[model samples]
Target: MELVFVPTPGMGHLLSAVEVSKLIIQRDRRISILILIIKVPMTSSILDSFVESQSRDNPYPTRLTFITLPPLSNCPDPSSFSFFQTLITLQKPLVKQAVTDRISKVGSPALAGFILDMFCTNIMEVADEFMVPSYIFFTSGASLLNFIFLFQKLEDDEGVDTVTKFNDPEIEFDVPGFVNQVNGKVVPVVFLEKEGGSSMIIDHARRFKKSNGIIVNTFTELESVGVEALFDQVSKNIIPAVYPVGPILELESKTRGGSQDESQDKILQWLDDQPSSSVVFLCFGSMGCFDADQVKEIANGLEKSGHRFLWSLRKPPPEGKVGMPTEHETFVDVLPDGFLERTAERGKMIGWAPQVSILSHQAVGGFVSHCGWNSTLESIWFGVPMATWPLYAEQQLNAFELVKELGLAVEIRMDYRRDWKTKKANFTVTAEEIENGVKKLMSLDEETKKKVREMSEKGKKALEEGGSSHMWLGRFIEDVFTNVASN
Candidate 1:
């Protein structure tokens, strides 16, 4: 069986696709894998680097192929295009033509199925035409997907104006499988908007309804309630098929090659030299860019807390520059005066660090995260607690799940302007709030530390052989593949 995995552009989406593809190859000896990506003009270089790295470290019997869809400069956002429409509408044929040509050469034996990103909905038509099954791969948590699925039902039942109550401060609605009634001002934000508040979500939800099956990057054990609730929602047959084969870090770690970059090696060495559970690592993700004021506030907050810390400061390039800050001096002016001198003995700052290795190290105690799903899962896997400061997208919702629902992290304050400003105007977290959150997590007192340690053990147990995630992954392979392929 040959499975062609198609992911939307972006590091997180592509990484999730790569991680799952790695696992699928491991589970089946006879199956072959190909990764299909849409190469946005200048951005194709990133995928080129990724393909080169993977080919050098092919851990599967199946060879990997990198095929590009023709450039679609006319699409509103070329990176966000779906399957058939984007390919069919383009002036010159790219994805469709290339795929059709490849199918002819590889023959039916090598044309088993397509594993597509959820946003790549148009692929279903092509899969049907080719007589191949296409599974939808959701790169976020199952809870998020469940919310998306439910949002469609709410919209259908309530109509577009279904809830004039949306803008209201608090609204309570009973979702099928959750234990508690969901409440929030932006509760329907998951399905209501696209591009984190645009009209794209409605279209994506529509696409989801037509998918063959859903694959999420989360395991069942970590969120039994949410996972079970998801199953319940789909049980009535209103939903497409779903599978939870995750704690995807397990697969990533397994396939991560031994070749480490020089900068990453330096970061690891610095982490190794720190005392166990003594340092806090702060990072706001790859795309998280702070204005000068916000950067100053982070420096002030960290200095006030007086904890040993390591931060990945990603300042946007100087005026007219294309990328991010590449030198240490770039942050000198933005940070507080005498900041390095005062914290010199206790802190080590870097432009970027080997995040996974640092999290796995014994010296790290807590994570200051942007609440991206991948970062959240990594934190949970390493048993390191988080200080959630979500910057964009469903991150705020994910933060709610972590701090309020899961009792796993602390949330910094965010400005909620029900009537005044638009959603883009995010108020910076005050130094006082950051200080308090840090003190709460880094408290040397054994009682608080013990509780966090206990939670970490629970996280570890979940990924083990008989753990919830383990069983769910096993069931996913058996139920999704074995049953269908044999027939």
Candidate 2:
């Protein structure tokens, strides 16, 4: 049997989905995966290279396949909700036709199900048309999933003015996955808005229930409270079966070929020269970038902190747009003059990073990150403590879980968002603020460090034969087969 995987076109989502597909095929030889690659604008910088590498490395290419769908001609050019909404709509008929061709071929493998990235839930319609079971592979933690379900319940079932209530700091939500009641303020700013990302998320959350299950990229041991909360009396009715089969991280670097390899060698060499546990590594997710003013503050912060560091600084998109940060030929334009020379011995700033490898390095002690779920899991996997500086998506919420709910990470600023139109932060994080966060992170207390180490060990064990995630993966496969047979 084979399963079709539909992942949102973002590099983070696509890579994680690809990793999970490899894991599933490793566990059960009965299954092969066909990843349906949807085209999104401006992702070729990394996406194309990663896909090429996967094709090159897969020993059994037939069992692990990738099918790129034809790009839509008039899909909005931006990488916003509207672009994705239109792309999915126009691509639906193509997706259906692809499925038709696949299962229709003579003596081909059985089409058991589809595993969709969270944002790609609207494509479940194609799964329904094929009479196949589909699962939503939530790339975030179980806590965020709980909140999404709770938000959907309030807006659709109970006639509450959800956005206004979410905005009110006094109105804390009772999310089953959280130990403490939380105001929606800490979540992605989009959730509080009436349209744009908020509408996309709510619409996706509603489609969530129509799927057979949710395969979250988290392990039960790492998120015990949040994973268990879904089965609580109140949530059971609203939530579908959840499989916490993860910490599905890429142990190997998905190197973008060409200069990427040379860059990695230099990065690893620099880390090797540093003293053990002495360097702080700062890398935001693929889309995370800051304006010139914010960039100066960070440079100032790093210089004042008096610690060895590795920073990945990207060129922010032009004002009045939201998009990926491009590589800067030199830091001279953004940095304070003589700043690079002054800090040359103690710090190194590059354009791209090999995060998993860096986290695993002996010289790396702490991560000052954007708190993307994939990055969070990688930090935990390597036992590196983090200081959260959230940029976009449900990152602020992840920051909250790490710092307050689980005590796994320190906070730079729990609530920070960049205004897309102006391409500047809603409010700047002064050099002093950045310095303080770095100090707290570098000199982090032993208690939090111990928790992170323990969790890291748990994350490792979860993919072992008898571990929680392993068992959950097995259960998910069985359920897919059962559901498909019944269908």
Candidate 3:
């Protein structure tokens, strides 16, 4: 059977979709996968990197295909915009129709089903027209799905002021099905904004409500209540199916089994030499960037914390673009005095680290992360506690859930939101906050550590035989191939 997978343009989203596609192919060699990447000439490097990464001693079947669409109206214009903007803006009519036409022309009666990223909801119309079963794949955490549903309900009922309640510290809304009260400001900017952003999200949410099934990058055990809550809240007519098939890191590891790449080797080597549970790994998600001051503050904070850490300090890409930073060398040179030498015996800093391998390392005990949903889930899967420093997008919400709700993380406060003026006026976090957060996470007491270890063990087991994630993936394949495919 042949299947088409459509992913949004961001690296995180692309990686999630790619890993899922790889897992599907791994389970069934007879199934062919085609990945439709929204073509952007200037940003092809990002796409190329993903392709190259997939080539290093991986078992993903050779039948994977990448089809690029021509620049068309209604397609996101990628000429000069940030990654997220490019993704949401690409709602061109011509491109949408072209994508529809291309899927229809797949030429095989054996075309079974489609797996589509949530942002590409525009594809659902085509799915309906073609009468093919399609699954809505959420590339984010279940909390995000919950937030989307809540935002939509609020907008429909209460109007603009209700949305603004998100930023009010005193106002907390009881999220249905879950006991936690959420701060309004933590909602993603996309859903709250008034301009082009809101429309895109609304469009996607509408499509999501229409899709035949829902697949998320999460395990059922991790958010069983939230998932069940979401299903309950959606309209009964369109609540097709929900599956939490994840801890996608395991799939990545399985796909990259026996990899011998130099980058991977270097990470292993670094971990091998470190004392067990003595190293901290720091990384922000793909799009997270700190301005020059924030970066220096981080370096100083890490130094002051006096911890043995490995930081993946990726430079900010050319101001607005997602490619390599133009002054990469100069950027490295601006580190605080003796930043390298002072931590010479204790820490290692690199541009990019093999994040999965590093996270899975025995020596690595805690992660200081931007709390992207994927990163958060990976930390849970590996049983590592976190020093949460959510920087952008849904990261704050992810951090809140992990730290406040799950007791798996320590929150580090910083002005992470986009309002520069507000950030300037109220950003109270400093090097001290970073130091304290790291110290707290790294110094989990024996009892706390034991609890963390227990959760981690449970998490790992879920990816193994008969675990929730494993069983869910099995059921998903059966449903998609047998039920959806037969239809």
The models' CA-based lDDT, in order, is 0.67, 0.84, 0.69
lDDT for predicted candidate 2 compared with the true structure: 0.84
Per residue, candidate 2 scores C-alpha lDDT tens digits across 1-487 of 9999988888889888999999899988989999988876677546776787888998668799988887777778574547667777777887888878888999879989889899888789888888888899999998888888777878888977677778864566677778887855586777787867667778998888878889999998878898888757226466678888999887888677678788989999999999998999998877778877888999899899998889988777766655667754424488888888999998998888888889999999999999999999999999999999998778889998999899998889988886544565768998999998899999988988899999999988999999999999999988988898899
Residue 373, candidate 2: Cα error in Å is 0.4
Model 3 gets an lDDT of 0.69
Best by TM-score: 2
**Model 3 pairs in collision:** 73-92, 74-91, 74-92, 74-93, 75-90, 75-92, 76-90, 166-184, 166-185
lDDT of 1: 0.67
Q: lDDT tens digits, residues 1-487, model 3?
A: 6677878766678788877777777776777777777755545566666655565545654557666655534444433223354554454443456446655774643566677888777666556665778788898867788777666666665664443556565566787545688766566655555555565566567667677678888776677668778667645653567777776753354222233365467767978999999898988765544666776887888888888898777666555453433211324566887788888898887765567788888999899988888888778767888887776667778877777777777778522564311222124357888888788888988776776677777767776888987787777788876665467
TM-score of each: 0.85, 0.96, 0.85
Q: Which ten residues in a row have the lowest lDDT in candidate 1?
A: 414-423
Off by over 4 Å in 1: 41-43, 61-63, 73-93, 106-108, 160-164, 172-198, 250-260, 317-330, 414-424, 444-471, 474-487
Q: Where is model 3 poorest over a 10-residue stretch in terms of lDDT? A: 419-428
Best of the candidates, lDDT: 2
What are the runs in model 2 whose C-alpha is more than 4 Å off?
77-81, 169-171, 233-235, 328-331, 420-422
Runs of candidate 3 exceeding 4 Å displacement? 26-30, 52-63, 70-109, 157-162, 234-238, 250-267, 318-330, 418-428, 481-487
Give the Cα error of residue 318 in candidate 1, in Å. 5.9
